[model samples]
Target: MKRLLLERALYPLLGLAVIVVAWQLYTQLYAVSRIVLPSPSDIALASVRHFALLLAQTWPTLGATVLGFVIALVLGIPLAVCVANSRVLNLTLYPILVATQSVPKVAIAPIVLVWFGFGMESKLAIAFLVAFFPIVVDTATGLRSTPPGLLELARSLRASPWQVFSKVQMPAALPFVFSGAKVAITLAVIGAVIGEFVGSVDGLGNLLLAANSQLESPLAWAALIWLSALGIVLFAAVALVERLVVPWGHSGR
Candidate 1:
């Protein structure tokens, strides 16, 4: 188990290290100009020089992403419960949920800005819209997947409905819920960036826009790197929580 865990951790780092070295070698071999693609060293230097400003920009995007994800989480699980428990909602709303995802979030971003204005409100709405469906679908599947044997045992014990749900169904659903949350968190960041792209004056997306407009490739790469780091950090956080809450779920992984 320890060897498995160590390999899991080491493999990604090894892959990343190889990628970075190859990236550096390719740029050097081709004599690639910074205008087209900044070298990793250039990005590192730019990141160091502009760390404070980039961090300041990061705060707003991170805030928007978190708020949007929280809203998605608060509403999604209960809606899933309704859909899972009620035949009517499952038949009606499932189609609606699937349909919502069909409409492109980017195309609606301007209208969302119109509705919620240029503040973080629009960003929140965009993030929530982008992240909501995955959570609902995953959680509903988990809730419905409660084992028949477990349900029968709970009934035999004379457990109340609440007890059965809380003890058996919720636990069974948690790993799935976390899986959706992982996807949602990354979506939330992308949603925030999209909102910023459409209207906002600040955030990493805006920084990227400004940098690219100025032909500051290194700075743009820096912003892109920061955004990627943010997504990775959030995803890692969700994974950590999963390990703590659903230890047995790893057998499948």
Candidate 2:
């Protein structure tokens, strides 16, 4: 366990070290233009200088991501339960959901843009689309495949349908629900970025676009860095929630 923990920490530390070394080497070795690839130090300075602007843009993107993810949870969990309960609904809707995902979000972006305009609504729609499927599929599987013995015991006890579901199905399904939530949170960030990329006046994605237009490579890199950080934060938040809510998961860990 100590070795495993050390090994996990080692990779990220080594990776960051390697990246910094390579960046320093590139800046010194090749006559790479700063315009094309700014030094890490340069990017760091730029980030500090423009911190307020970055923060201002970030809040909106964060808000949209949260809104979309919440919407996904509200919509997807119930839908999963519905499908889990009914073979007919599962047969009819499962394929369609799969198909919906297979279609590229970029293709849907314009339609969403037209319907919801270039505001947070379009971004929220995109985030919801990206997040919806995983939660539904994972939760459905979890709900339907609860431990056979427990389910049998519930049936034997002549428990009401609501009681069985509330006590057994949902609790058993929490782990799977959280698994999907982890995926959804990451996708939510990506979706918000995509929505901003397509057309938004604000967001880290917009910051990236604008920086690209001006050929401000360092600022763009800063936004990319922040975007990655945001993803990490959101993913960690879900993981923390999972650890708190799923006692079995914590005990297993």
lDDT string, candidate 1, 1-253, tens digits: 9999999999999999999899888888999999798889989999999999999999989999999999999999999999998999999999999998999999989999999988888888999999998999999999999999999999999999999989999999998998999999999999999999999888999899999999999999999999999999988988898899899888776
What digit string (tens of lDDT, one per residue) describes model 2 on residues 65-111? 98999999999999999999999999999899988888998889988
What TM-score number comes out for model 1? 0.94
lDDT of 2 at 245: 91
Candidate 2 global CA lDDT score: 0.91
Name the candidate that leads on TM-score.
2
The positional error of residue 162 in candidate 1, measured at the CA in angstroms, is: 1.8
Candidate 2 stretches with Cα past 4 Å from truth are 1-7, 250-252
Against the reference, the lDDT scores of all candidates come to: 0.93, 0.91
